[model samples]
Target: MSESYRVVEPQTGVRIGFGDVWQRRELLGMLFQRQIAARYRQMLLGVVWLALEPMAQLAMLTIVFGFLLRVDTGGYPYPLFAFSAMTGWWLFSKTLMSVAGSLQDNIGLISKVYFPRLILPLAATMKELFDGGVMVVILVGLSMLYGYLPTAKIVVLVPLFAYAALIGLGVGLWIATVMVRFRDVRPMMGLVLQAGMYATPIVYPATLVPERFAYAYQFNPMYWVVELSRWALMDKPVDIAPPFFWSLGFVCVTVYGGLMVFAKTEKIVVDVQ
Candidate 1:
């Protein structure tokens, strides 16, 4: 009798394949919940911190841009202008900060587990989404308080938010991957984000960028994100064509490029540790 022969496939050492990530979906949910709870864990004010930060920033921006800087957000009230931009900016900044150090901070889990590395940054994104919901409620309340009624244009906020999330995720993925290799990226990211707050039209109107520099200025993706948010909430007229194309282009390049870099680096992540 002939002996039976069997062949076994070799393991690739790629710990985070697509199926592995899907299998761990429940872990993602738990991480999301933990992030929310951890954020307000020891704070006396608890979840109120979410509303307070944006509200305070809105007030400050309104005063500085409306009164001191004399920047016009079309005919919309400055508070509304600032608040709308703040809505998007808050989400972007929060997501960036949360994901930047996620890989490094969770090195223990990464080494111990065989789940997708992308989950770390993704969990950070989900936490931002939860925080963003609180901001939306605050924005609605402020609109009512200021007597600005919502119109059909409010529907635009959906897509505008989706675009913002893509920007945040793309940037976060890039930064998170880099921070894993170079810890210095985190502090430098903080400085860049701070400068970005002013560079972006968060507190000011996009028109303030002189016509001569307009083309060069659009390189900052946040410019379009902020502009779109204002247009959605304030019913302000915007040349959506140019900025929309710019944002779409940015999303494509960053997400693709970031993923490539992340995929390559993730394999060697354990070696670096």
Candidate 2:
């Protein structure tokens, strides 16, 4: 057998090369598999929980908002309406939480090994994408049950899902890098996610938001994802206005900055861990 070597370069200023992560795709795949296994290892239903967890959330939201509050979903069934948005929301929330905690969660492997630290968050994002994909499948079935078959608009969901992942990964990277030192960040993100869910129109219609505050709401990245997703899946009316472009621009800035912060601090932060 031939010996292989990986050159160790002294750390410099912030530099981001995703190509380094791509070259080690095998390691990325391995890490993804390990995360899937560990996540479901102790669970009774295992992979079933992926479907069950989202469905359970859907049921509760339907009861509270649909039955009791009587939130108007433009005559569309509330279960389908809420769930259509839930699919994307679930992807964003899970990816953010998973990627934010990834490095700290794998402290054992990270401390002992020299693989690309970026792979940890990438792997966590992949696992959540898998989980989100399951929710999408269920969404399609749920849509059919409501007598609304998918249209050409369904194709839009692919890019929309990608947009959600970028948003989550962008924010998560910053949180993960900081979490190496400040343990409070994890719980802080938990609270943010809680508030964010309500702030986004997940349980209610965007029409419910007063017209005065609507413009400001459009700047929210989650608002764009959730609203556009509703348009794609439920035929809900959504305008591709200037604010939509602004939200996309926001995502681009966030992901780039997050990558920089993570890359710059990765070496030093691992030491803290």
Candidate 3:
């Protein structure tokens, strides 16, 4: 006689295991679509805000850093230099903030849902990725207007964008997991983001860093993000070899650790007061 084995699904709220997310993929897609629609549904400007936000922020940086601080950018125009760097920085920053606040933002749903908790963070990230694409279109137009013709170097942005996503999501997942237990994390992340803007070379050129502090600076993952972004779009110099490996190692650790921690805490998140 022949026998057939039937597999049983694992209980939800136990752990955010591999099988759990895969089974709930449909719900994730539904949530993603809902977020996109909700973002532009009531607003008068709608999607245009995505394009305007980056340009406005860039203009502010141009006035403050380029003209006020007089941060040198070799020969490339300040607008172009800042735009290229901001592209990567905004992606990381926006995604991190969205994902970090995912849990708190979806309290009503979280209290009632039985799905893998990871979907909230993933959906929040998708929203930012869509917003980032809008900014990229503006970037191309600005590049042409500045008389900086696009070159084959622009191809490198693909990997840099993906690298930024990984780092952003990786860090976000960690924060989201921790925030579920300690509500204080929400306020602390604001301070971190505020400080992170100055810590990175978004408005200024990486060349501005002194030789004495160069070694310590490389430890910052975003340092490579801005460097590679400029190298790709603005024809600026960057030491790609080291940053490539450093970012990859950092991504692996952050993502893996974040997932493991989330899996452990997933069952208890909704119960937290």
Candidate 4:
């Protein structure tokens, strides 16, 4: 077998090459599979939980905001509207929740093996995509049931899903770096993500946010993803173009910074872990 001398194990320094990561692409696939198996291993329903859990959450939200509170979702059916937005929100929240401990969770592998550390967190996202696809299938079925036939614009969900993953990875990288030393970060982010769900326009419409906070609310990266996704899936009336571009800019900055922080601190975290 040919060996690469330049690529060192336990990647050191600030330098991380995309080529090196690509060379180990098989490792990413393997790790991602392991993550999927492990995630649903002990649960009674196994992989089915991935699909059910999101549906269950959507049901509860639909009850609270859709019925009791009677939140306005325009003329669009609340369940369909909420589910479309929640799909992206779920991606952002779920990926970040797992990735917060991606490295620390794999301490055994990290200690013994030399692979791209970036793969750990990126791999965390793969399982989410699988689970998210399950939710999307449900969404598509529901849209048809509601007589909101998907148009050619439905293809736009591809990029919107990617945007969600980037947001998750970016926030996850920063959280994972701190988590190596501060164990509390993992649980704390869980609570934060829980709160972030309601904070976004998922449970309610953007009109509910009063004029003053609306500007600041748009800064939430997932907000744009949810809005864009709603527009793509259901033709929901949301101002796009600008938020789409701004969200892209925000995610680019976040993912780049997250990767940098993770790369720079990878060694120190292993030492600390």
Could you give the C-alpha RMSD of every candidate to the true structure, in order shown? Answer: 4.0, 2.2, 3.1, 2.5
Q: Which stretches of candidate 3 lie over 4 Å from their true place?
A: 1-16, 241-244
lDDT of 2 at 108: 88
For each candidate, give its TM-score against the true structure: 0.88, 0.94, 0.90, 0.91
**Candidates 1 and 2 compared by lDDT, better number:** 2
Q: What does candidate 1's lDDT look like per residue over 95-149, in tens digits?
A: 8787767788788988897677888877888888788878877886787677767
Question: How do the residues 1-273 of candidate 2 rate in per-residue lDDT, one tens digit apiece?
Answer: 699897778887677878889899999998889877877897868778778877888899999999999999889999998998888888998899998998888888888888778998999999988888778888889998998889999898888998898899999998988888899987788788989998998899888999999999888888888888888877888887788889889889989999999998788865786
Q: Which candidate should be chosen as best, given lDDT against the real structure? A: 2
List residue ranges in candidate 4 displaced over 4 A. 1-12, 38-44, 241-244
Model 3 TM-score?
A: 0.90
Give the 10-residue window scoring lowest on summed lDDT in candidate 3: 7-16
Error of 2 at 219 (Å): 0.6
**Tens digits of per-residue lDDT for model 4, 1-273:** 697477547644686456767989999899889877776777768767777777888899889988898888887888898899988898888888778789888999888887778888888898888887777788888899999888998888887887787788888888998888889877678688888987888888888999998887887778888887888778877775465577678788888888888888777765788
Better of 2 and 4 by TM-score: 2
Model 2: worst 10 consecutive residues (lDDT sum) = 264-273
From the highest TM-score down, the ranking of the candidates is 2, 4, 3, 1
- Candidates sorted by lDDT, best first: 2, 4, 3, 1
